[model samples]
Target: MDWVFLSELAINGALTGLLYSLFAIGLVLIYKASSVPNLAQGGLTMVGAYVVLALSHDAGLPLWLAIPLAAVIMFGLGFGIERVALRRLAGRPVIMILMLTLGLDIFLRGTTLAIWGGTSRSIELGVSYEPLFLGDLFISRIHLVGAGVAVALFVAFMLFFRTRTGIKLRAIADDYMASWSVGISVEHGVGLSWALASVVAVATGVIWGEIQGVDQALSLLLLKGLTVAVLGGLDSILGAIVAGIILGVIENVGAEFLDPLVGGGSRELIVAAVLILTVMIRPHGLFGRHDIERV
Candidate 1:
C-alpha cells in the first residue's frame, strides 16, 4: 500500500468533510432552535444555488454581489416557511412536523423545477479549480477555499451566539415555555433560526455548485447533510464538525479500498454504515447531550 496515496485521500476527504459539516450545521441549527430536523434543507440548498446561478450568470451580476443577495433571499424564504407554515403547527405531533418538512422539501423541489427546469447549469463563483501540488500530493484550490470558508463561517456563527439575539435564541432552545415566561419571543427565535439556516444553505450550495454544477442532483446533498447531522447529533454543532470529518475520511479511504472488493459504490455504503453504527451505539451522538426526562 502506497502511503502517499493514502495521505492524499485522507487530506482530500477531510476537506470534503468540512464542506459536509457546513451543510449539516444548518440542520443542527434548526434542530437546536426548534427540535425539528429540517427535511427541506437539501431543497433549500439546491434552490439557493440556483438563485445564485440566476443572479450571477443570468442576471449578469458579479459573483460577489450575487452570493450575498441570494443569501438574503433564501433567508426570507426560510423565515416565511417557519412563520407561515411551521408556525401553524406549533404543537403538532412529531409525525406531523416531520411530514410538514417533507412536504416543504417537495414544494421547494417543485419550485426549482418550475423555475430552473431539470437541467444542470455550470456556475462560476470566481474560485479557481487549479490544483496546488505539495511535493507528491496535490489539492484543489476550490476545496481549500471552501474548507476555509466553512471554518471561518463556523467561527463567526459561534461568536454570534454571544450576542443578545443569540442569547435569546439559545434561551428559547433551552426551554420554549421558560423563554416565553421570560418575555423572549419563541416565535421570532425559531423564525430567526430558519432564516440563518437558509443563509448557511446558500453558502453550502454555492461551494458545492462551483464543484459540481447547479443541478437537481445537488439536492442529493441533503442525504449527506442528514448523515452528518445524525452522526454528530442533530443539535450539536461541534459534533457536526467532527462527524463530518470522520465521514469524509471514511468515504474516501473506504471507497478506494472497498469499492474493488464490493464491485463499487462503497462510498455511500460507508456513510450508511457509519450512520447506522452511530444510531445503534450512541443515539445522542458523540457530543450530544442525552436528555433525562422526569416521569
Candidate 2:
C-alpha cells in the first residue's frame, strides 16, 4: 500500500529484468536459428567476463577497449565452438545436441576456473558507485547504465533483424531444411547466430560483473536466463523481454513482502512456483506459437 516503497521495488526489479533480458534474448536467438537449447550460454557469458577482466586488469587496457575486445573474443569463441563441435552434429537428435552443449558448459567452466581461480574478483569498470535518487526512490548507477545499454542494444537488434542478414537468420530459424533448400547457407546463418549470441552474452556478462562482480557463480546466470526463456517462450524474443520484466518485479515484490513472513528466501520460492505455474497453465508460454506436426 506504500506507494514510494512499491514504486522503488518495481523500478529496481524492472532494471534487473532488463539485464536478464540480455542473455535471454541471446538464448532465443540460438533456439530460433538452430533449434538448439544452448546450455553453454552461461559458460560463454562467464568466459566473456573473464576476457574483460584479463584485458582490463592484467593487460592494463581501458574498460572501453576491454569490453569490445571481450565481444570479439566471444564471437570467435562462439563461431569456433559451432564449427568444431556443433556443425557436424546438425540434424542430430535433440538429446544429443543438448548433451553436447552441456559438455561445452562444463568445458568452458573448467577453463575459467583454471584461469581465474575460485575467488570472486571485482570488475573495476572505473564507474562511480553512486546511487541516483528520486525523492525516496533510489537506484544504483550501474543498474541505470546497464539498463540504458540494454535498451540501446535491444533497439539495434530490432533494426538488425530487418536487414538482409537478419532475413537469412530468420529464414534459418523458421526452417533449416527450407533455408538450405533455398540456397540460404544454413551453416553460415547458424554460425552467425552463435557469434551474435556470444556478443550479447559478453554484454550481459560485463554488466552482471559490474553489478555482482566476477566469480564462478556468474555461470549460474544461465539458469536464470533459461528460466526467463522458458517463462517467455523458447522461440520468442518478445516473450523473453516481457517474462524477464515480470519475473524481476515479482521477485522484488515477493522478497520485500513475503520473505519476513516465511522467515527468509521466499523470493526464490515464489519464482520457482511461478515457473511451475507457467508450465501448468501455458506449456507453450504466454506468447509461444503452438506447432502442429502431423506425424
Candidate 3:
C-alpha cells in the first residue's frame, strides 16, 4: 500500500537489472559475431572473479592492479579458445559447433572445480556492505556501483562499435566471404569478439562476486543470462540491454508481491514462463531479425 516501498523495490530491480545486462551483453557479443552459442560465458566469468580473489587475497596484489591483470588473462584465455578449439571447427554444422561450446563449458567448469575446490571465498572490492538508509528507503552501495559500472561498460561498447575496426567486424558478421574478399580477416574478427566477450565476462564476474562472493554455483546464472538473451534476441545488443532491465524489474516485482501468494520461488517461474511465451509468440525475440531465403 505504500508507494515509497514500491518505488524502492523498483529502483532496486532496475539497478540489479544492469548487472544482468552485463551478463547478457557478453552473450550477445559472442552470438552476434560467431553465430556460435557460447555456453562457456559463465565459466569465463567465474574465472575472472577467482583470479581477482587470488590476486588480492592470496598474492596480496592491490585491487587496482588485479583488475587489469584479470582482464588481460581472461582476454587471452578467450582468444586462445577461439584460436584452438573453434577455428578448426568453423564451417561445420551449427549443431556440432553448439555441442563444442557446451563441451568447452563443461570442461571449464570441471577444471575450475578441480583447481579451486568447492569452497566459497569472499573478495575485497573496497565497497562497504552496510546498507544505506534514506528516510524509510534503503539502498546498497553494491547496486549503485554495479549499475554505474555496467552502464559505463555499455557506453564503451557503443563507442567501440563506431570505430573502423568495429565496422569491419559487423560487416564480417553480415557476410563472411564478402568481408574476406574485401580484405577483412575472419579469424581475427572472431577472435577479437571472443576476447571482448571474455573481458565483459570478467567485469561482470568481479561485480557479482563482490556482491555475493565467489562460488561454483555462480556459473548457474548462465541460465538466467540465456533467458535474458532469448527475450532480447540472440543477435541484438540493444535488445539484451533492454531485456535485462525488464527481466530484473519483472522478477523483483513478482517476488515482492506474488511470492507470498504462490508460496515463494516465482522468480524462476516468471523468467521461464516469459521465455516459453516468447518462443511460442515471437521465436526470434523482440529485436531479432528474421531471415527469409527464396529457393
Please tell me which predicted candidate would have the highest TM-score against the true structure: 1
Best by lDDT: 1
Name the candidate, 2 or 3, with the larger TM-score value.
2
Residue-by-residue lDDT tens digits, candidate 3, 1-295: 6988887887788788778888888888888777776888888888888888878788889999988898998889888988998888766777887888888878888888898888988777888988878778787888888888878877887778779987777776677778878898888888899999989988888889887778887787788888788888877877777888888888888798889999999988988887898889988888876776789
Stretches of model 2 off by over 4 angstroms after superposition: 292-295
TM-score of each: 0.96, 0.95, 0.94
Candidate 1 wrong stretches, greater than 4 Å: 293-295
After best superposition, candidate 1 residue 26: deviation in angstroms? Answer: 0.8
Question: What lDDT does each candidate get?
Answer: 0.88, 0.85, 0.83
Stretch of 10 with least lDDT, candidate 2 = 283-292
List model 2 lDDT by residue over 48-72, tens digit each: 8889999999999999999998899
- Model 1 misses residue 250 by how many Å? 0.7
Cα lDDT over the full model 1: 0.88
- lDDT at residue 125 of model 2 (Cα atoms): 66
- Misplaced by over 4 Å in model 3 are 133-136, 292-295
Worst 10 residues of 3 by lDDT: 168-177
